[model samples]
Every structure is written in structure tokens, then in C-alpha cells.
Target: MTKGNLAIVLHAHLPYVRSEEPGSLEEDWFFQALVECYLPLLETLEEASTAKDQTPKITIGLSPTLLSLLEDQVLKNRFEEWVSIRLELLNKLETNCTAAALDLKGHLKRQLKSWKSCKGDLIGRFKKLQTLEIIDILTCAATHGYLPLLRENPEAVRAQLKTAVREHQRLFTNAPLGIWLPECAYYEGLDDLMSESGLRYAVLDGHGLLNADPRPRYGLYAPICTRRGVAFFGRDSESTLPVWSARDGYPGNPNYREFHRDLGWDLSIENLKKIGIKEKRPLGIKLFKISSQNTSLEDKQEYDPQAAKESVEKDAESYLKDRKKQLIKLEKSMKIEPLLIAPFDAELFGHWWFEGPKFLSHLFIKAKREGVKLITLKDALQLTPQIQLCNPSPSSWGQGGFHNYWLDKSNAWIVHEWSKAGREMVSICSGGLIEESNIKIIKQAGRELLLSQSSDWSFILKAETTTELARERINLHLKRFWILINAIKDNKNITEKIIDEIEKEDCIFPLISPIDWKKKI
Candidate 1:
């Protein structure tokens, strides 16, 4: 077994947001991340693939919903169109700009060139990484369900896992060895569902394992196996804060690119809002400069790429030093060299923090030299199976260190409504149905119920982080539940119509096997 383990797990997910009509900005959230986080990360991994020293063995969880969207013909075609538009803009910037502003034009030209270089075959890069064994990608619940709260029916929770397993199979040609519970929200005895789904291990919030009934011996530094034979790795909070914290983290560094102020909003929204009659809205890679707040657009100075690279190197050092200290402390005290698990939302890399991909690339390069072994949760568990049997308490990596963030008074209404609907659906499905096809309808309703119960959607809305879209998403799924439930209750036999409408509007996780969900538990 390796002495000490350092694993980084990134959870990539977003609620199903798509439109049938073409040329929609609503889909840009996915497009932007593909351009910023996903494609860049894949590119970095591919670049490091040949380097013997750059053993960047990463593990990331793509929610089933996200996997489905990635494979969508509609989204793929739309993405191609968006990329083509950007390429044309790049051409205009290069050819039309006057020689007087050569420096500004040159800067814009380079940024656009980078975007153009990474256009087609982006998805192939990820597939290539998996083929190269540089990354071990995992799958989460179909819509990232907060399963602990869904304990009213264990069968419903099982269905969520089953859907994820099937979706993973459909995408990658293999079932995921590890499962990422939505929000790391877990309750005791949830191991049964995980084991049934054939997951070897999963991640938990620090205190979930720390505050277990019989406290974990190695605390958050080691893995815990349940009686069900599933393994659990508690997140290393000590290691996570260095990257996650705003006040003290790398993101707060002054030299890094500013995220808060965007020309998208600051520039005249009037011109950008007009469609057919106006000139195209420049894609923010522009003639304008990047400046901090309180500075007018006219007073802005040029962006410095050199300065940004220097900042990345410094943050990489700070990150390495902290990890070394933590490793040393664990090695001395735990006797068995501890594993440091750092997990974050994948969007953190290039979406919110523009320079974050560079930070990660530098950090990986440094960690390889500094002796940080990046392993997957499955690799850690296989090498060192837990001797101690520990059951984690119910928890989430949210405010108050529990479920309050997703289940507060503001969001409790959602849970109450969904749980009641789930119970009714479960009872209806379990009470013998006449036709086999009717049984399929009941199970389909159950799947929709499970999707609607995703706690992340509600929390995102209530937090006002991305309030408008989050609100719309929660309502959209909730209505699906309402429609499905009413149709089943009324015995209205329009299953094909209902399914067709859902398939057309939001075609995520198309591997929705009603049979897998309806299997007698």
C-alpha cells in the first residue's frame, strides 16, 4: 500500500437546462463551462499524458444528467453553431482591426486563437483521458438526489442509484466503481443501496465519519468500510479549506483575473440586447480592457498574461507547502500515512475563477515533484480496506455542517411536497397494478419524483446564488412530478404522450429504464 494518499475529486453537475428552439443563451452555461473548465482540464491532462513525472491521476464525478446532456445531438449541434460564431468573430477581430491598436488586437487575437484551437473534438479529449488512464471518471445520481431525506422509501433511493448505474454504463461502457452522493448527503445504513448498486466506495463530509456512532479511529484521514462491504472516504477538511476559502485561498490573490466585474453586463446591455438590426455583441474578448471595480471602462489598462502566470506559481507553492505540512502531521500521528481527500465543484476551476485551470496545472506539476500521490477513492480503498466498521451520521458539506442548507425553513416546503408525492407514488406502484404497461407508467412517475427531489436545485434557488434560473429549474421538474402523479392517480392512459413530451423538452438520462426502477425491492 502507498504510504500517504492525496486524491482530488471534482463533482461536475448542473440541472437539466435545455431549449428545443435553436440559438438559445440559456444553453450557454453548459457551453461556457465546456470552453472554460471541461475542455481546458482535458487539454491539460492530455498535455501531461506523455510526461512520466506528470502522473495526474484525477477522479471526477459527472452526474448522470450531465452525461446525458453531453451526448445530446441537439446540444452538440448547438455547441457547434456557437463555436462557429466565435470563430467568425475571431476572424473579424484579426482582419478588421487597424494597425494603430495592434497590441490590443494582438491580445484579442491570441485569446480567440486559443478558443478556436480547442473547438471540435472536445469530447474526444475526455474519452482519450479515460483511454489513457489519466482519469477515473465516476457517475452520480440521475439528478443528484439528497438520498438521506428520501428515506421515506428506501426503494426510491435504490431507484436513483440504479438509474445512475445504468446511465454510467450507457456512457462509458462500464459501471462506475465509486458513487458520488449528491451534496455528500448521507445517512447511516445508506450503505445497503450503494452496495446493491455495486459501488466500491464513496465520499462523505468530514464530520459524517468523525461523528459516527463509534468514532472513526483514523478520523478524516482514512477510509471506513461498512458491513455492506462498501467503503467510505471522509473528506479532509484541513486540506480542502486551502483551496476553497475566499479570505485566505489562492482565488483572493490580487494578480489573478477578476471574476466579479464582467464586460458582459458593464458594457451597454442595450446594444447586446438587440438582435437582427444591430452589430454583433463582442464576446468579451474585446477592444475593452479588464479593470477592477471603481475604475471606469475608459480608464482601464491592458491585461498582463505574465503577471497572471507568476501569481499561479506563487499560489502553487503555497498550496504545496500546506499539503506537505498536513501529510507530515498525519504521518507522525496516525502511524499509517493518511490520505488527504480534496473535493470541489468542477465549476470552481474556470467558471468562477478564470485563472483556476492554470492554478490547477501548476499545482499538479508541483505536487508531482513534491511527492503528492493523486489516487482515486477506489484505488485507496483497494490498497487499504478499513478494519474498523463505521457508519457515518447524516450530514452535508453545507452551512451548520448538516442538512440545514438544503432543508431550512425556506426550502423545507420542497422536501415536504416531494416526500408526500414519493410516498403516494410508491404505495400506488406497490399496490398491484392490472396491466404490465400500467406498472411501467407507475415506475416512470417514480423516476420523475426522484428527479424532482434533488436538494441541490432548491438550495441553489434559496441561496440566491443563481436565483432566477434555479427557481425556474425547480418549478419545471416539480410540474413534471405533478403531471405524472395526477395522470397515474386519474388512471389516464396517455403514457406515450406524457413520455414523449418529457423526452422532447428535457431529454437528459434517456436510459430511464422504468423496469430498473420498478424492480421489487
Candidate 2:
């Protein structure tokens, strides 16, 4: 008998990293995520759908920026070439790691076949799954902007939500009822804005609900509803930690493939350049197993695909067993049915944890046998007649359970830049007559401004990984924003070529409106 519900929310997002250069780091980021994470995830879900006893259901949040990237024809074509090149490189592997290389090559070949079967239409495939009720899709903030930080200019926050809704509708043909707030970050009044945008629900860190105005009667097991009518689900730490923590989770198992040790870093730079790579960086060709947590990369043993497969199956069984026990205990003590919300970054599944996708597939198969009900967030809402009403606390999923991670010394500088650009955007959209000729310029400026507000930049700065690229992206957007805003302010006769050039590079949110930044009365 089913004891309780388990809602697994995977928030999928990537910064707008489109690049014209084939071997650019930005391009590599998108391609690697496509090959290692997204494609594998889709394949896993597709495979799980074939099971007759249980239907796999989960919540996946696709940010507007990532949706745009997925729909881009240029990126789609490049992904095929990217896979071909990797396959070629894998075949040329003449080393002690040949077995591992061959294993990865086979996986890639299957993924490539899957890509072909879908005609490289990942977005359509995901949409079809949603149509089949296998998954509930959520929209994220436009460009994955940190909503709480943008709250200084309320209109800025509104623009982010509105643009996301519009873009999601354009692609998915309906407004999203829920959102995976960027970083699972929430502030005191964010629900009002979400309600205004017609969003009905969102997921927040456990504390956001735990520390509510009046403590929830059922705590994190049940969702809380704000006066504004938006429902907020809190993350269940018990359900998340075992999968999210590398040190303590199933992902750290010694049999799993080691993510950090890759063939890209091992190959000579001269040889890499021969394949069009200009520098030494991860090329997503990992072949080492985490023999031990303490083992150095060089000392790691060669990955055995068979051993990793066994580990995934074993770990999935253990995870479901734990959930079953927890749910049964909670059902006995709780007044209402218990819900364990396990929210994670979607990329973690297949990218960071090599066997992540297979693990999920295993979860679906074992969940039925284990008597643990796996349902989507949308389905969880219906479990209770009415949600507990409370004002959630200001919180984020970042370290310290607050905004400090994104607002710390490393990234605090960018906040002012975001605020300044936001205010200017509002001024331009509010004050202007919006000539037919300049509407294009104003819309482009709005795109640039929104791009600058991406939380990824602040995240990168704080993490100190790819800081230079983060800084460059933030400045690039701000610089272009100022140029476009100035042209509108000065009423300069800007050439069509100039505007065309800017649009060609950072083109996203084709349906974005400049008026979204207009100050609310």
C-alpha cells in the first residue's frame, strides 16, 4: 500500500551562453550540458514511460533562457557536430583507458541515436511528455534572474516574471502554473508578484516555510499558501541530502564515474587544438571511477560501466526504501498525508553524477515495488483539500539559508549594477513615446538588461569558478544596454546595421516587451 507522496522537482537552467565561435567556452557549456545532462535525462524519462505498472512523474522547471537555447536551430545543428567530434576523439583513444573510452563511446552513440530519433527537438520531446502527463513543467524567471535582489525595483521583478510567462506561453502554448524560483530563493512579498503573473505555486527552501509567520501545523510535509493565493512547497532535507550531497550521498559511491577526472584535461593542448579546441578544458570525456573519496585524480581507478550500473541500481533501491520508511512513519504521526519534496538542480543528475539519469530510471521501477508513491508537484497539491495559510520567511537555498551567498563581497558589486540598469530600463520604457523605429532598440535594451540580471553571474562570482567569464557576461550586457538606452535618450539616428548586429548576438525572448519594465502605478 502507498504510504505517502514523494515529489521530485528538478530545476533545469543554464545561462544564455550562445556563441558564434565553435570552440568557445560558452558554446562548450551548452553542448556539454546537452550531451551529458539534458539528452540523457530525456532518454531516461522516455525509457521509464514504457513501464506498465508505474508511470514516472516528476516536476521539471525549464527557465525561459534555457528554452530559448533549446529552440535555437544553430545550437541544435552544432550539438550534432559536437557529438560527432567527441565520438571521433573517443575512437582515437590509444591508452590504458581504452575500455572506459569504448564504454563512453557506446553511451554517446546511443545518445546520438536518441537525438536523431527525436530530430534534435528536445523541447518538443519534453512537451510531449508533459502532454502525456509524465511530467509537469514549470517556468523560471526570465534569464533566471534573482527575484529577491531585483525587488529594489519592483517593476524589474515584475518584468522578469511577466517575460517568463510570455516566453513560456510562446513555446509551450500555455502559461506555467508554477515556477522554480531562481536558486529556490524567496523574499517576503514575492508571492504577490507571482500571483499577479498568474503563477499558482513555487518551491522554496525548507526554512522559507518552516520559519513562516505562524509555524505551519504540518510543517514541511504540507505546502503553505500566501494570502495572495500562491502555494509554496518547502524542500524536505531528508529527501534531498542523500541525493544532493557528494560527500554523504549515493553520488559519492566509489563505483560511480568520477566527474572531475576527464580526458580533456589529460590530452595535450597541441592535440586538443588539432580538434579545434584552443585551450585545455573539460571536454566531457570522463573515464575514471571514484575508487575512494580520498583518492587523487591520478590515482583513481578506470571506470567499469558494469560496476557503475550495479551501484545505480543498488543506490536507487536504498533511496526508495528510506523514503518508504520515512513516509510510513510520517503517515502514522501526521494528521494529513505527508509529502516529501526533493528538489534538485536537474544538471546534477547526469552531468555531475554520471549515473544520475540511470538512478532516476531505477527509482521509478523500484518505487512501485517499494510502495513509495512518486508524484509530481501538481499532483501533490491535490492531496490536501486546502493548504495551510502563512506568510513564508525571506529565504534562499544558498549557504546560510539567506541571500548572503549572492550578496556577499564577491558578488555584491553586481547588485548595484543590476539595480542601476533596471532603473534606467524602467525610465526608458516609461518615459518614451516608443517610436516604431526605436521600438526594436528599446526591446533589445530590455533583453540586454534582463540578461545582466541573471543570478548565474552572481553565483559564478561567489563560487569563484569562471569568474572572468561571469564578469565579462555581466559587463557585456550592461554595456550593450547603455548603448541602446543612450540612443533612445539622445534620439540618435542609429543605423539598422548596428541594431541588427546586437540582436544577432544576444537574441532571446523574441516576444519580450519593453513595457514590462514600466513602473507600476
**What TM-score against the true fold does each predicted structure earn?**
0.87, 0.98
Candidate 2 deviant stretches above 4 angstroms: none
Candidate 1: where are CA atoms >4 Å away?
A: 1-3, 23-25, 84-124, 275-302, 434-447, 465-468, 493-499, 515-521
- Residues 53-81, model 1: lDDT tens digits: 66677788888777666667777767655
lDDT of 2 at 161: 97
- Candidate 2 local lDDT, residue 290: 95
Q: lDDT values of the candidates?
A: 0.70, 0.91
What's the distance in Å from true for residue 46, model 2?
A: 1.1
Judging by TM-score against the true structure, name the best candidate. Answer: 2
